[model samples]
Target: MTLFRQIYALLFVLFLLIVASIAYVQFTETQSFLSKQMESDINNASHSLGLMLVPALEAGDDVATETLVNVLFEGGYYQQITLTWLVDGKQQVWTNDIRVTGVPQWFIDLNLFKPITKENVITSGWLQLAKLEITAHPGFGYHEMWRIISNIIIVFSILFLIAILFARVGLGMILKPLNSLSEHAQKIAKRQFGPDMPTPKTTELKELVRAFNSMSAQLKQVFSSLDEEVSALRKKNLVDHVSNLPNRQYMVSRINGWLSEPSSGALMLIKMDWLEDVHSQYGYQIRDETIKLLAEQLHQQLDEISPSVIARIAAYEFAVLIEESERDLLTRYLQCLIRTTNKEISKAGCKPNERFNIGIAERLGQMTVTDILAQADNALQRSRQDNKVFHWFENSQQQLFSREDWRVKLTEAINDKQFQFRWQPVMQLENTEVSQRELFCQLSIQDNMLHAGQFMPFVEMLSLGAMLDRCLIETVAKHNLFERNLEPIAINLTFQSISDQDFHVWLKQFLQNHSTPERVCFEIPEASVYSDLLSCEKICHIIRECGAKFGIDHFGRQFGSMTYLQNLRPSYVKLDQSFAFIEENQHNSELCRALVNVAKGLDIEVIVTGIQEQEQLARFSELRLDAYQGFIAPPEEIKLG
Candidate 1:
């Protein structure tokens, strides 16, 4: 039982014992007092009546004697009265049966007041005329005793109830601090460090609350310190000091993540051949300033385009990866960046022609990081050889659909409800149990089965992400996937859907209709969360409120703070796929370990994706990961029920 209940119960029993003791004492004292008072009254009555009857006895008038005795007996106070004739040795008796009114038989049976008898001699001057005996009725004494005891009981009964109420309130007040401490501990368990608990009036509880607050503050500081350490490590290793852009290692990992997906993008490599000359002429400070300025300009220009990465790969070479599938827009952005770089270089006293040579390589089907880098390097060579500012790496392969064609295909797929979902099981490392299944949606268009990586970009580009997400949820519900598998299915939410308020409302209603909301898990990309934290937080709140789970996808891909995990508190986080190649990349391995630590400290599950080999799993195992999803357990088509 809770402390409050236990204390309350003990107090209740104590109160009951006190009331009983008081009642017992009152009953015994009242009974004794009534018995003594009855005895005194009877004795006084016997004496007075004997004196009054003396004259009648002296006159030898039996009628007068009988009349006096009858008067006393008929009064009902006396149970029996007798007049004895000493002269003639004869006796006359006047008696009445005892009867008590307005008292229970049980009280009478208790015999609280016993019958009292008193005797006196009737005297004429110096001699007694006749002996008089009177017995007092116990009925009156019994009635009086009952009345006093009943009143005491009634009064004390009410006092006991009032005392109980006061005790409950008092106990609640006394334990309030303990309750607050308990709640605070629960929050800490969830890795939420809230405000300090109020100090209580009780000395011991006051000390305890202070101690708890100190512990909570320390815990918060520890988590903050861990996050700071991770951030410092990231900056030290993955970030370039001169340009403040991502270093070469970071870019390679990011490009590898992109290449793993069945998507198309462009990598532009810029070689600053004149940077060496500038360093020799203008010193390190000017060269560093020039690089910083050029990096800032590049960031500003590329911010308007889709998500891209700008990195300082080498001392004189920088790379930019843009996810723009359109050739014309890519070319426009590249030209704009080149012009901006030329102006920065000219202002820094370098010839425009010697400033840089640009290489452009299109990210196409099944390309590795080396393949794309070598292609871009070849393009850079051609640009230097032809004396051109930029050159595109030539490819004979063509895209399956134009931008408009993709829009059309996505629209048709959504309208026709032709999106197919595959389930990839995520196994818990502890038990090898399927913790959840990550859902991957595919599009069926013109005899082609397109993976989510292929068409999702178009869905996002066309602003159909919300529509597609809604369709996918409905399909999952219709097929009763939750019932069939008896495990949660995590659905990936697009950035557009995460930001759409209407989609949030629809999702709330949909989950309300779906009885088993716990069977669904909504995953929002870490990139989306970085883009608009408020929107992501709102959606995450809604999802959790509806009894479903929320997780972060591509958790460590973005260069944002890990502190957001403390607020969003997702059920789990799938580390970006780039971390899957940790066996070959020690940088990724250390970064992954740091990310996992920060997340696990908050009690959030850490899941690594793209675990294709046992070695990758073995490497990640040291990090205490919860689960993983990749080709190790390939995605299976969820059969419709």
Candidate 2:
């Protein structure tokens, strides 16, 4: 229970005890006092009656004496009244017994009142004519006692209730500061700090809160320094010194990472045809300047889209990799990029013959890292031979639809609401509980169904990835998935979609409209975040503020630098499934341990994904992952119940 409730309960119990004791004392004392007072009053009445009846006894008037005794007995205070006279030295008695009624038998027995009897001499002058004995009933005392006790109980009850209400109000006010401090502490655990915490009136609590705030500020400053150092180190290693774009190594690593996910897009290789001539005529200095200028312009154009990884690969060549929602738009964008580059070159006073040849290739299916680079390079060779500005190479062996054809199919599927959702439980390995479930969405066209691998790349290339994300959000929201299950729902957002500003705004608003924003999580790939850490950081901050959680999907794929993690401290990170297969190996096990330790330090949960085998599950259990998802949990259909 909360401290406020505990204190309130203790106070209530104390109040009840005090009220009961007071009621008991009051009831006993008032009843006893009333009994004594009634005895005294009845004794006085009997003595007076004996004196008044002297005339009747002296005259030997039996009828007058009987009438006088009957009158006193009818007064109701006395249960019985008796008159006695001695005649010819023998005792004579007159008695009236009127049974007590209307009072409860239990009350009468509990109150135990003994009758009072008094004797008096009825005299004419100085001689005693007869002795009169009077008996007084105390039944009326029992009735008065019950009334007094009942009134005392009612009055005490009201006082007790008022005391309890005031006590609760007072306690609540006092504990308000403690509640604020507790929330502040929780936020600090999440690496979030408040503007200013309210100071408590209690001296000890006030001091504690002050200490906590001071410690929190120091920690944030320390983390800030760490983040700066990590970012500088990452930039130094990954970026080219001349062009200030990511180097060949970073680009290749990123392409490899993207290949692992179920998405596709295009890669453009731009070669400066005039660079060799410029270097021979104007020397290396001017050639370098021209290349730098060209690099700057290309960076400006490609940076507009998300997941845009630009790099300087060779002396006369630059690579720009982009994942778009529509490949058709990418072609238009590339054509525009080529035209703009030529204009900049002409403005730099280069001859009309000074031109650029570009190679574009589609990224799809299970292609190796070398295959993608080779195909783009081959396209560049073909472009140079054909004397064309650009050439396209289909990287995958499987024949595919043209960009326009796929676009129509995607639009029709969306219009027909042909998306199907499947749920697989993310099990909490420590216990057997399902802590979360991941949503897998597929496009259904007539009798054929296609997974994300087939269509996501098309959606991303066409810039329709944002639409796909929105469709998922709306479907999940409408179903109230969180309400149907005891766990949160995890949905994947492509790098292109998260990079889209419109999608970012819509997601924020959607979370705000829902009562349980925390019950929904957005899964972003590790490489996608690394591709654009600055933008990802800003996006994550906004979404987290709206109470939505972020998880790094496909973690450890880069395996080179985790510096981005310092900036984007997500709620959890899912270890890529490939690690699970090699978990029994000592090297992989140690690597997994290192990752878990790093995650634990940042207070981020670690979950292993794609647990398909019993041995994999057992091996991961030994590794102590926070959760696991995939076939080991066995796929189950979601039910509203």
Off by over 4 Å in 1: 56-67, 74-111, 117-135, 161-176, 195-202, 262-264, 324-332, 394-409, 582-588
Where does the lowest 10-residue lDDT sum fall in candidate 1? 580-589
Indicate the residue-level lDDT of 600 in model 2: 62
Best by TM-score: 1
Cα lDDT of candidate 1 equals: 0.84
User: What TM-score does structure 1 among the candidates reach?
Assistant: 0.89
Give a tens-digit lDDT track for model 1, residues 1-641: 98898999899898888878877887788778888888888877887787778778888988887887777777758888777788887988777876788999987787666678888887787775677778888987878887887788789878988998899888888888888888899999888998888888899888889999999999999999888878877888789999999998888878888888656679999998787888999898989988998889888877776568999999999999987366877878887888888888788777886757999999766688899999999999999999898999999888789889988878888878898878889998988889999888877778988787777767777899899999988888888887887789998888789999999999999988888899999988888888899998899898888899999988888886788898899999998987775345666567777888899898899898988878778887678888888889998986675
| Candidate RMSDs in order | 3.2, 7.4
| Residue-wise C-alpha lDDT for candidate 2, range 202-272, written one tens digit per residue | 98788888888888888767655554544454456556777777777667756765665576677889888
The TM-score between candidate 2 and the true structure equals 0.70
Against the true structure, whose lDDT is highest? 1
